[model samples]
Target: MPPAPASRHRTGRRTHGLLAAAEGLATAAALTAALPADAHDGGGHGHRPGRYQDVQLLSFNDLHGNLESPSGSSGRITELQPDGTTRTVDAGGAEYLATHLRQARAGHPYSVTAAGGDMVGASPLLSGLFHDEPTIEALGKLKLDVTTVGNHEFDEGARELARLQNGGCHPTDGCYTGKRFKGAGFPYLAANVQDEKTGKPILKPYWVWKKKDVRIGFIGVTLEGTPDIVSADGVKGVAFKDEVETINKYAKVLQRQGVRSIVALIHEGGFPASGAYNYDCDSPGAGAGISGPIVDIAKNVTPAVDALVTGHTHAAYVCTVPDPAGRPRMVTSAASFGRLYTDTTLTYDRRTGDIARTAVRSANHVVTRDVPKAADMTDLISRWNALAAPIGNRPIGYISADIDNTGDESPMGDLIADAQLAHGKELDPRTSLALMNPGGVRSGLTYRAKGAEGDGVVTYAEGFTVQPFANTVNLQDFTGAQLVQVLKEQVSGANAAAPKILQPSAGLTYTLDLTRSGADRVVTDSVRLDGHPVDPAATYRVATNSFLAGGGDGFPTLAQGTNDLVGEDDLAALGTYLTAHSSATSPLAPPAADRITVVQ
Candidate 1:
């Protein structure tokens, strides 16, 4: 369908008046009795008194402040095939996302756009440089009606998040542009994130999207395990509660307020059996195709909640998992980085003040850039680019070729580890080695420069994309034995099925024997440092990001280290190392990732 007339729609920069639902039906009638008693039983094209109203719930998640189109592998999505294979599609970028969303909302008058969170944080230089103000403004223009607080929202801490919502110049950086930071027009709901001292949520726990007579209560929550992933400073004075319990508690609150139709914007998700967004997780033969905490949350959550929109596990899927009442309910997630948007039809019953669950349908559509980019979004990007150009365009280093984070071990991960290791030793000479988590490597460093800089030049923006998390390079005291346990933790415990192998710096080597189960896979005899067997009883100084130092990413052993000495932020270290070490004549080459000898 073509878009609504330009005059009928408002720029994302203004309030989304058309998307709100009718609020509060005082008559209190059942959905079955919603139809008028005198209504004729004849078929007609016009809306019948009893027919349910379709409320379009548009959602996307894990945007990570991608104002511009993403590059390399990060910009592509895998599509499932009937032949059981997969094909990659290039998608995402704020400009095109806006057009697709506006077009999708064209014919639907009762539509609300929401997000599952991770909208900002770990952002690219263009957005991250301005403290994600550009992204917030861009999202505002995109008409993000509502969103939850994702783990990345806490990257700079609760205080920063409050600033993002409440409007203000960065306390330190102040206002970057002539325009004042007006915060978000949309509310950031954080039902599960509570203040440790006050015992209340850090932000508004829930939000009600209201039109004249219809209301839909939205309860937003970050993952309960958020503390485990974000830096310690980010969650210093907050407590994360159980997702199911928080949602159940708020569902009752919403019910008491006469808001029967509810949606849970949860920043937690699961994996699909197939990579395709259309994969049928509910198929009898699918057999636990969609698996994760959301499954349990869906099964145990009070049936009062009608739908659960989730993120964080970035994969996309539109599935129905039975609720506590054994009634099938919608559960959805759009892939990360704005590549896709999910369109969920929530059939509302005016009389019953509840949703017709059976009629609910959801699907994820790619945000293809083939169409014209939204003029407002394009203007927003252009304005921000002018301000970010100087700093973002500076050349940091040169690379021979693309350094990608691939498979069992990645060359890019090793290079990052080596950089961190070098930076760590400069801070504390005793530091023996450094390790980089696979997930931290956001994108590959392309050899063909993205900007006007020479072919092999690495622009500051490119480097920021590769390592967006503002994590500090931390050094801590750990015994050789503890280090070994840390390596084992990669493939054991919570990571056994999905191993998050830590990329190590030069001089550190080990054999990963997949034939052996769990911790035994880390061949102890093969563990070496500078060609010497690492002594278990000997004390050593290990280096890693602050996230790992605090036991993030299931590596509990790393948290056992003592004598913390925080170094420079990881991105700074990478930038400095690249600037000081690489040149055009002799550019840095991708590491072989041979440190970890994998044996099947």
Candidate 2:
């Protein structure tokens, strides 16, 4: 299918004639009950005479292009049992996801699949090697109807994102399949992302999924703070607006156009009370059940929007956050990496032309690996693997055990920081320490073999998965005062709510007091390097990725470093460090992750 057509006018500001034309089109479309050829056969329920219509909405998010089954913890979903214990279920993989989604839509003809975004960034080698074309094609095969754009969508910048939306091969890489890319089969909504010059959405702000008389409008928006997280170059020409304002504005547009059944696809999400996919957020006395930016966004969204499908925090929850009108509305998120998918039933009230908010039901289901794999998805993965195997299978180094990226200070994060520091030392012997951003460490290195690579062997593909952004290892000079400020910044400013603790390398130790809040969390006097206190007047050279050097996360203080010197790609530095530090006789063991002394 061709890409969805772009809107000629700005959303929420259309001319009166345009609004009238839209209303007329909507009315004409609603008068017919004929199901399109591509529409699912709702098991003879298409013509059922009822006051309300049940529309199945299957949604997932933050699929970072693990076309195959993800390895390690990334592929598992926690399931809460009746006895109150939890068990880990092997989940994720496009193959199993396709099977689950197809099964979920079996008897529901009005099923529409959507996503909350991050569908194609920080991807595995199979998809990342080809700029996530395989994943995009797989999304099409899954029959996704619409999605919002996550911050990772701008990893390669707006022009690349546009190419992914529209059809074309990479401007530099050309066609990997020797055929022209067909882009996304569904519309990507970006109601909040606007062009800096024109003040219009970068993509279609909203998309309407029509099935004869059943029409559901979807408005998609990423977090307004997208610019702070993304690389400067990635979000250069676009501006991200407030999520609530953007959704509210487009909800009115859909209402004005006579399409009242609306769902807001928000890319920002909340932290649920529990990690289990089956956790009951609405249980008695669970209170809000979730917290973070999504709480306010969901509560303030106009009542015109019946439900919200959210992601980014990668937490799972199905609960009601009352809308502005004080009516409880569904808010949900399926944990990231396609491990879980939320199935929601929206009862469309025909008379009111809106959803029966009281009848809305949603739950997250794990994409269990036990199901029969979708043959087409398996074939797609095989094709991509065949192409990627040449580069992906090459052994980079060896590991003694799994270096998991979990906890406040992960072993994988420490290893990465140490690797980058070694690379920095090569460029300049005076480089003192390295700090790695938590978000940049995508996945952990599992010692077990994922492919043909033997046990304990680390392949280039695995390293790439851990660090996929192609960020450079950069060296910068900072005085002791500025360095201390950088550490404090991790808990202050934008990070105050969600502290993004930077992983510290060997010899850089500090005390983190959880009892305190904000900058005080970093014990000022306890900051040390190689057993020596950090003198306020001393200068130190630090190594960090390009993202941190430019203050990408919430560490704005890091951007103040002087004497910038860019080195090799961060992944290459990791590969070099692993090769030099490990061998068949003596493989590298997981870092102890004790650099930061935590006092809770």
Best by TM-score: 2
Candidates' C-alpha lDDT: 0.80, 0.82
Alpha-carbon TM-score of each model against the true structure = 0.89, 0.92
The local lDDT score (0 to 100) that residue 573 gets in candidate 2 is: 96
Error of 1 at 551 (Å): 3.3
Candidate 2 whole-model C-alpha lDDT, 0 to 1:
0.82
Per-residue lDDT tens digits for candidate 1, residues 422-454, read 999899999899988877877778887566898
Candidate 1: residue 321 lDDT (0-100): 81
Candidate 2 residue runs with Cα over 4 Å from true position: 1-48, 284-287
Measured on C-alpha atoms, candidate 1 has an lDDT of 0.80
